[model samples]
Target: MRVFAPLLALGLMASAAHAQCGGPFPAFVKGLKSEAVAAGHKQATVDAFFSGVQQDPKVLKADRAQGVFQKPFIEFSRRLISKQRLDKGRAMAKKYDATFKRIERDYGVSRGVLLAFWAFETDFGGFQGDFNTLNALTTLAHDCRRPELFRPQIFAALTLYEHGDFDPARTTGAWAGEIGMVQMLPRDILINGVDGDGDGHVRLKTSAPDALMSGAKMLSHLGWRAGEPWLQEVTVPADLDWSLTGPGQNLTVADWAKRGVRPREGKLAQGGLPASIILPQGRKGPAFIAYPNFNVYFEWNQSFTYVLTAAYFANRLEGSAIYDAGTPEPGLDGPQMKRLQQKLAARGYDVGKIDGILGAGTRAAVQAEQKRLGLPADAWPTMALLNRL
Candidate 1:
């Protein structure tokens, strides 16, 4: 059985979810309260949790406005990883050296990995978000787009509320209801939260150690291999087959090395480690060899660009050298990309959502179409590829 099986069973109940997710706001909250009580939560607790909770249109707006991720890898990474963040990450590492050491020893998650998330999620706790947590959860749960994913989080928050950790009116966080410095969902907190400071509560908002350790524990649950390398910038041979590139293809580091892929700075991982050479831009752009541990990043966030940037930031925090941003071919804009996705979908390819984002499904389809068209299958969609399609 999965963790939180009883709660998860309630979360997946279509009858309750359809009534709660499809009805008017008042009816939705009523159904949710009824379901929560039926799922073993006390009536008083559920009522207090839902008291004054209202749908947040702002959260829905933020959910739909993810266009910032459309930026190219170089642009996105540069925008997120600043000199100040780098220096702050180093200082924060030193400040919490003891806690990080304990976390590394117990969880096998490096400080750099946790620090990168800390820096990105909320600027090292400078801003944990301002949206009311309960309202955000209720808003998302009531929305029809992705109610299944958000419904369980409500109960998890109620669990925290019962433990006197969460405040329905005062607990504020990201628009998506992720709490604390590292922006973890409520379910993640209930499952992987760590009391790093040992004050008897997993306080992620106010305590740096609590947030850092909790974040590490969550990453560990996401399949992060302890003490394993995740990403390394690399140089590829001019004669290497471009068709073998992209995150979809994996080969041993030894195999990649034989194909003339060399590390840009430090030595590569073990020869036996399975790695994929990902060209974030195109054949001429920056390249990196992502190891198995890198796959776990997707469990935290689905955006490929964000995951790559976070992995690269972790490397930078550990003193990795800057990557060479080779001159890559220009990619399509939002409209052009949407057109490409439509074309790919019409061709019977599952380019999910057709949302103009170059997600994994779209990239996979692009690679397949590129290979079929006798073009370099680097998986970076280009105008040429779009025209051919």
Candidate 2:
């Protein structure tokens, strides 16, 4: 699941309305109620859904404080794919073998991938969050920064409630209004939900089969190719062109082998499928040959660390060896990243904004600066890079 940044400016703008509508929070909910009715939702259903919904300050706090997004890839992966999570995933796989098989046959998605998402999203159904789905969506939609993204979700949640999928009072999940064991958004639930438990209804919170199969359905719809590996841990030659090591640089296996790229654990077949080299921790750390199917991971979540961690976890569940990267140097924290971005901008690098998100533009600027400074242009930001900047 992707974490969203809170719209503090929007919150400030809505302050006067908040004072007028009993409070900004209540005003926001009231406005959503009017919009819901105008959008063809039954008044009764809307009322019932928002029966006791209130603006949760904690939701805003969680939205604004997404620390995991700023962590280094290895550290994030270690925390996400722990031995406990792996063991529980294996147990769930064994316990629901038949359901997984059925889902695979129907959706052509790997069971391991589904389990990986489930484990990472909510600890394999252990803790799917405690925020009210209605309140969260309403709060987000009322905010201006991502109103376009959350408004539709609010309506989708209302539709689900009207269709008797789950009680609004009981429908709880992440701060971004993601429900179910796999933390699916309300829009995804309305579009890609599936009845995997043969219960004639999709209940993602309780039924493992339902959640897993629903997740599989989502991946399938997102263009997951059957029988294709998402990524392979590979070793890139030291003298290879480091600039080619990132997303969108698709090259065939033969092409990569010609450039001295080889799998760390297995031999690359001649004239193999197209794959992109990904240097998640720069040239000093791990390298991977990401296949075309890897795009499905992005569709699942936009965070590169989250996508790689989920893909690596799924591969591990399928009996692949752990990543063979060396210990990476310490990376920059949020403030350090912002400072680095400022330095790069000072050097006339188009890093977009100094928001400290480490997005593609910032990374590309880093790569350019590294090459200019005669440093290894692996594009991974570190404290060393910041100090030099």
Best by lDDT: 1
**Tens digit of per-residue lDDT, candidate 1, span 1-389:** 01111222433244643444757999888888888888788898888889889888999898888887888899999999999999999999999999999998998988888899898889999998999999988898888877777777888888899888899989999988889999888888887888889999999999888888888888887788999999999999877887787785889999999999999997999999999999999888999999988988887887899999999999999999888999999998999999999999999999989788998899888988988998887888999988887
Residue 78, model 1: lDDT of 95
- For every candidate in turn, the CA RMSD to the true structure comes to 3.1, 4.9
Where model 2 places Cα greater than 4 Å from the true spot, the runs are: 1-23, 267-272, 327-330, 348-357
lDDT of 1: 0.86
- lDDT, candidate 1, at 208: 86
lDDT of 2: 0.79
Clashing pairs in 1: none
